[model samples]
Target: MIRVKDIITRINSSSISRRMGQGLVWSFTGTALAKFLTLLVGIICAHILQKEAYGEFSMVRSTINMFIVLGSAGLGVTSTKYIAEYREKQADKIPAVYAATNYFGLLMAIITAILILLGAPFIANNILHHPSIVLPVRVGAVLLFFSIINGVQNGALMGFENFKAIAINTLLGSVLESVLTIFGAYYFGVNGAILGFGMGFILIFVTNHLSINKNFSAIHIKKLSIKKLHLKDFSILYTYSLPAALSALLITPSFWLIRSILVRAEGFQELAVFEAADQWKVIILFVPTAFSQIVLPILSSLHKEKTSFVSTLKYNMLIVGVTALLLSVGVMLFGGFIMRLYGATYDNSVPVQILAISTIFSALANVLEMAVYSLGKMWQCFAINIVWALLMVGCSYYLCMRGEGANGLSMAVLISYVVSFLMFLVYTIIVVRKEVK
Candidate 1:
């Protein structure tokens, strides 16, 4: 058996550890600035829009976001992996990879926008049951096209480790979004709020696109390999993105379903409270997310050569587990203040507490899910997530029917994550050990 002392002594020499530190420094800086900006926007918007209207506004934005992920087509992710892998070894291939990813993502996003535009009536009137926002939903389709393409750029930048450009883009985008949201809400009420939301995403796309071109000037139209690109290469890219897009297609509706269930059970007022607290969930998650971004490309590049990923996993568990605990405590103590940002109606704290508690398990799951992705096990993670999402819908529905309130829904989400974390842990162990064999 490996001895404890030897394991402890060798920790300092791990390459992943060193690289993690480097990636974390950059990622943390960007994530911090970006999340802070998002938080400020949410707070101000909540303050400006009244309770029910604020709820409606959040619903429109969240629903739009849910669909936006579908456009990623996994190529957004594959770009980062392929770019990182080939950056030094196959430098000429960079332009081909970039062009393929960008063009493919943009194409898919445009199609997605069309679909959203066509379905906005059904979604707003039927699924959302909030026909008042139908116009906003239609307007949001344009934003969807832009946002999905932006994901492609951001993913490519992540591959190049040009986090400074990514950070600046995010900071600028968030500030613009906040200003517009506040101004629109102040003037035109709910419709203005919706305008700000959609326009903000458009600004994000423009800034990110410009930033990527500025940072990676090698990929101009003249330098790209579009003329030489073959059908087989596009087919290969399609294969990479199919599973991701499929997952997004399923997952986005699942999220929409949960909010739908919650609103149906507890009303839009409670949904407002739930959304308000979720911002903090986003805040706490920024830490693990920063690490995951760094780890994905690293793991993708090194998966074949092999090393002990378990050590790094342990280090993350400690860091994220403890951080989650602290965050839960912080929310429990001061959650009221957070909800109060929305107004007196949101000041209820049970949902906030439940949501905060869930982040611990969710954070751990986020790391493992990404690790699984790194190992090329995308389908398993997706299957597992689909089940978890269903559980969120089913469990939340069953419990809320019993009069457990929004807390019932929140608890269901928390339980689903715990189950997911356990499943991922076991499956990952089996996969890793077998790989060694």
Candidate 2:
């Protein structure tokens, strides 16, 4: 065993190790609080709403989430990368970058709104096969504007390493959403749940907007004029961002396709099982989501310095792997009990239980994906995501057609995640090796 003095000396040698440990603690606390509140809200919704309604809600939310990626246009990520680089150079271009990108975000939001309005009916009727979803889908479309702006502001904050602000925004949004959703759903049912989600974003957007304005008073509206925007600068942003945007669109929307297939082939009950399992998986994902939020900006800064990418990758992998292992064990052990919190009916399905357990692999993959993104390997990430999405869609279709029910779908999910994780691992190894050499 190592002596206490030796351990203390080792820890003192690396400032990064110390900072990372602190970041992890803060991140874990914020994530846990946010996820807990969200999970509680989900539990309330699951108990109050019928499984069919819950499944429908999940489908609609997933569809709207897909559009969020478009509204974001990967600018948030690109902003973080560039802002971190600029800060290191101690350049005064920060205000200009912010001004330009905010305008870009607005433009993207406008275009997204138009696309949503034009395609709302078709998406609801044909794609989701639920014309009833049209109204909520349209309402959620308004959120695209809010989401885009929020992304930009949050990206900038992350670049400055303002984790406290980020944490506040996240926690506040989640808490407000949870309280509003629970009370709303209790009174007005499923539509209330949807409304609460919309309202939550609106509140977050307003709060963040105010905070940003106060913090970055130098970045005035006049500074954000389109006339001052440089096409060359915009091109640089797009060059870095397009892959991330494409990857998000390809990967995220595929969930809806799987949901649609399940609805058509297995009916609402099986869909409900799938959604239940997926909810638990989302809870497990909060760990990685929080980690990514903190890691990306740090990695972006380090990358600009031409640091040891291999060591960074190894460190990230170790932390993520250990976290994933603990979460997996916890989730697997408590999955049945967790399901019971949703409702007695949710605990009936063994396959759903198994699916929730499989989230371990998915969570690990998500963490590794974040590592890849940090290295600015968005093209590789995009390619791998597309391949995985295609495979998931195919597997989902085949399983649904075969009438294996929710269990079959779960198996497909497990296989898809395993494949994606392995692919990400191989790609990460190659990229890290190249960077080191």
Candidate 3:
């Protein structure tokens, strides 16, 4: 206990420690509220809608989430990285980061929304064979635009370490969205729920954007003026943004592939069951994810100076390791009771158990992935994700087609995540060795 206290004291006294701690505190508050609301919204909709209708709702919300990631083009990450780096060394370039994020994120958001709107028909009818969801898909696309802009706002704010604003914005948006979703689902059913859920993005983006802009005077018309944004500025911003975007592009689509496999192979019921169980996985990842968000900007700065970050990384990994151990055991024990909460229909705990087991691998993968991101190994990270996504889709497709149903899909994903975790761990070790020497 004394040794642990000393180590804690040392960590708290470090330069980046306050920033990381504040980030975690604020991020955890916001994340807890947002995810709790999400869980509530899921329960409300599950109670309100039919099983099939609830499944469609989950699918649409998931799709909008994926599309926003694609549309933002990893500019959020790029902005965070460059802003932190520039703030430390070249303050003059900070404006360019802000300018590029505002204009470029908006452009990408618009394009992404349009694509989702236009592609809705083809996706619902041709690919998904769920024509009734066509209009709902379009409705959800509204969130895509707002979500990207929120990403832009939050990215810059994160770089600036404005957690108070981020926390407030995230919590309010989620609360409003949850409130609206409950009302809408009760009055309007599945489609209304989809559109109402999108409202959260709108609320969060607008409020957060305003807060950030005020905090940093981020939208300086002078710096953003057409003449000031030289080609070099664009080149620099795009150069960093592109790799991150490519990584998101490669990764986000896998969500749809996973959903589509369950939908086509079995039916909406299977998808709903998997979705419910998967929410547990979200719970397991949430805290580590919050830590990762806080660490990224700090890591970005440290990496810029070529400082040794292995200690920080180790501490972060240690937190997740203990969490993984406890959660893995808890899930093994309480898997059935958890599924029971989703109502009487979700009786089978097998999928939940499988996903619970997978969370251990997923948690480790997440930490390693963040380490690589901190090292600015986006290209190497992208290669691993490409392989992971390919393996996931191909194996999931084959297994689902084997008529083994959602169980098989779960097993396939479990195996794939395990393999990916091993690869990421090995990759991070090798990279850290080279960096150390």
Candidate 4:
């Protein structure tokens, strides 16, 4: 018979649980503080900028993020998955792997950045339908390049489980970005705000580079050899990263399209309200997002241990699902007060409450998605994301057309995620059964 004390001792002695505890502590601390600063910056910007300008700022940022998928090309998860799986087994090949990822990431970044630069005016005029904001979109192009490289670097660190370094860097980067963005918005309005965001990404890229260098030395990877990268070195990119990248291609553009539909159907005022409520969604998810990040590397390491992997995945879903429910309830209870932070223009509570409820489904889907990633089933993941993205875009476009405004868009999110959670649930159960057998 097992006693409570024995259970406690066993948990404490478990290597995976101990590492997870340490990672969560640092991840929560840094992510919470960083997201708080981000929220603060948004509030200040909303108060200072006109509603239309704030809307434009939000739109430009979204467009940049859409393009960012091209540059990132799923390399972030690719790096994390491979590095975590291979570090102990193939320590000597770590440098080659790192070098190969960087080379491909850099090439993609250059191509995507140039594409954005050349196409900004067309995007502003044709897609966004606000040609006056062309320069801001151009500025976002620069941000895209640095942001992609930063994702790769951060992914490498996560693979190594260097949560302490990630936490410190995240804190410092958030502080710098908050100061610069606020200053820029104060002086030059929309364009300056976008420029400030670009500068922040540059700083993050440099700091991450420094951290990765030190991590390499600590892990006894003496050198990263770009010169020796061969065809085999790039197999991960084709096998895993391509499907992951294609999945992002479907999802990110769908979001940009959804926002575009809302903006065109209802205009910037409605978009501002949507963006305002969306900030809270970001805040509530940030904690769970941290948990997901920690779960990925740990799960990747346990991929060969089917029973432990299934147990870990179940535990993660329970924790994240419960936490999401509590946070959603809290947000609903304080909906009006939270919306008021963005000032009177965003005082509507319906959208906030609607998005709050959506968080529960999003949380569950995230855990299942992580399991797919850990098992290296990128094609299956992409297939699921296709359904997810299509539902989101279709529902949002239809609702926005029906004149429900921001509230409609929020409802679309809730609906899409509900279906997605069920789909992921069925798929994950099948996968787990097979693995356990």
Candidate 5:
């Protein structure tokens, strides 16, 4: 039997273990605080805005997230994978990698932002079927630009293992976002809330930019620009990012489509209940998310070491599984009370509980997905996400047509993740066998 004392002593003795412990502490704390602040803002919005209005805000937010997948072009994970792999092995090439990533990242951000801006009217009118939200959707284009830039920079910082900077940034950004969003929802309703969201992303982008500059200088990179594009490094990034982007294309838009179907079939009031439950899901997810962030960097560095990589992956899966089970239990126990915080209108508990169950599946699947990324097998990642997306969207559309509303959508999400987790498990086993051979 393993003893707690022995485990603690071992963690204290190993350098990598010590580093992971520190990163986990900072990442989890920062995520907890930030998620709390965002949840607070969400509660405030729910109280201030009517159910229909809050539903509209959720729709706009989902739409922007969908657009952001295009803007980011999967450069964030690509940045993290390459930076972590190269920073220690080929330190001299770090600058070229960073420069090429930033260049393409910026180019994609600008192009997607332009597309979102020009197409906002059409999206609002046709896709969302809420022409009144055009201005907010347009503002989200600005938000998408800053968000994409910040994502690449955030990934780079994580590669550097500078969790302290990320923690500080999360704290400051969350505070600012909370203030702006609360104030906006209280005063001007949904549009103001979205504008506040944009402003918050902009602030984080500025801070992340500063962090990148410092991280670069620490690594002896004199400047952080592409003076001459390195086609080799860019090609490598592109190869990885394409499948990653395609995976995002499959995932985000499927959720967006799910929401669209909900609104059209069941109306905004039902969407509001689903959105409320989703907030709690986000809260439950913060812990695993923090773990996944740490896992990516460590696993990326260990990818070439088959034994270490496989061992670490098993450990990560164990930790995530245990923690997620506990959180899901808490959600099941307190889901109704938690939903009531959003407002009486959100007091429905079944959807929240169903979503809580999904969190367990999601947490484990996410860890496996991150491992695939660390191994640089992104096409496999895309394939898994495509299957999950098809399952989710198809099930959701059918249920929405049956007038199931929040319960149906939540069930769809749960089923999709469960299937995705099983598939990831199979793929990981296959990869492990190949590594052994």
Candidate 6:
């Protein structure tokens, strides 16, 4: 019924709306593509290697990630927060922040590497129940250096709002990792897969270093003076980031503990099933994880503007809730098909699928948690995350002992999110309400 001119106007308005609506979509798509490539590499490794071999690889990777968290010392996040704040006022200070963060991150990485190398034998024999993992765990320790460097560079790039570079670097690293992993597994077997992962981290480190150097060439390394680094700046950055870092340290190990329990109680086959389900869960998180990255800089900028923090929080919740809901539905519908991609052994049962799909809530909770971090409510975020991690351990132990098997493990994860989400909701409401008044 509308005239052609009116229709054109309406079309233009809709086009604008679509672009706004697709903000999360675009970010998620880029991340999903990168993860898909990485997952394809995983798939090839799974097929080429035996179940025990894949299980061993997974165990070593988890161990490496745990230590890497400590090595990072939360500097990446602290850098992002401080860099975002300082970039507008004293743009010159940005390089100093970068330099200080890199120095600290490297120092922490060395400490963590020493501890990991010393404890590798204990961890392999006791925690993983696989003595063969000792060598690979040591090999993965080398990644800590590269990871620390990459973290600093990524934080700086994110602060600068260089999403295109961030996305490209991630994609290229993932693709290269995939290719190298396939080749490594083909020629070198399980140890080769571990080597390939280390190589991937190295590639990312190099790419990010070059990219950051090219963009900030004029900033000059001579301008970065640790002697000029003020305690006040470090305190502020630590106050804002310490909670999130502690929370990550506390929470990530819970998964490894859960796996340890399963391996000790049930056996490697059960661990294999759990690993397969966990992989899919990680894949589904690719989109939400990417969206969180985009959201962080925006929310940080809004906080700096002294905008209504509650409004920003609500907007983030609304967007994340909707996106999470749609993605959850899709995952639930197609999860079994996706699991079948791993192999017939991993097709799993109905209950396991249902429990795994429940992780959508967990992913949504993560997005909300990030929003809180953006608002500088890291202490509260830390409290909630720790509580969730504890609940996960308790529930997983009880369910596994009660004979729930992989389903119990999945249910434990789901319960942790439910409790954590409720607690976060209460905390957010109380805090935001007080701010409103």
Question: lDDT for each of the candidates?
Answer: 0.75, 0.71, 0.80, 0.86, 0.84, 0.71
Model 4 per-residue lDDT tens digits across residues 362-385: 988988898888888899988988
In candidate 1, what are the lDDT values of residues 83-145, reduced to their tens digit? 777765676777778888888887889898999889998988888788888878887787788
Query: Which clashing pairs does model 3 show?
Result: 73-245
Runs in model 6 lying further than 4 Å from the true structure:
1-30, 214-223, 304-311, 435-437
lDDT of model 3, residue 86: 71
Would you list the clashing residue pairs of candidate 2? none
Write model 2 residue lDDT over 1-437, tens digit each, in one string: 42545444444565655555656676667657887887777777877777877776667677767777778778787777767667656546666677767787888888997788778899888876778878777866776667767787787777666666666777788888888778767887766776777666766687767666655554332235577666775774666778988886877678777878888897776777777777767776667666666667666666643444444545555555666667766767776776677677776555555665566667667767766787778888888998888888899889889997777777777788889989988887677667633
Each prediction's TM-score versus the true structure: 0.91, 0.89, 0.93, 0.96, 0.96, 0.88
Summarize candidate 3's per-residue lDDT along 171-248 as a digit string, tens digits.
998898998898889999888898788888888878886776675565342346655787777774556677778878
Across 121-147, the per-residue lDDT of candidate 6 in tens digits comes to 999997777898888888877766786
Error of 1 at 74 (Å): 2.3
Clash pairs of candidate 5? none
Query: Which candidate comes out best when scored by TM-score?
Result: 4
- Report the number of clashing residue pairs per model: 0, 0, 1, 0, 0, 0
Candidate 5's residue-wise lDDT over 311-352, tens digit each?
667767777888999999999999889888887767689999
Candidate 4 Cα lDDT to native: 0.86
TM-score, candidate 3, is 0.93
Error of 2 at 346 (Å): 1.5
| TM-score winner between candidates 3 and 6 | 3
TM-score of 4: 0.96
Report the candidate with higher lDDT, 5 versus 6: 5
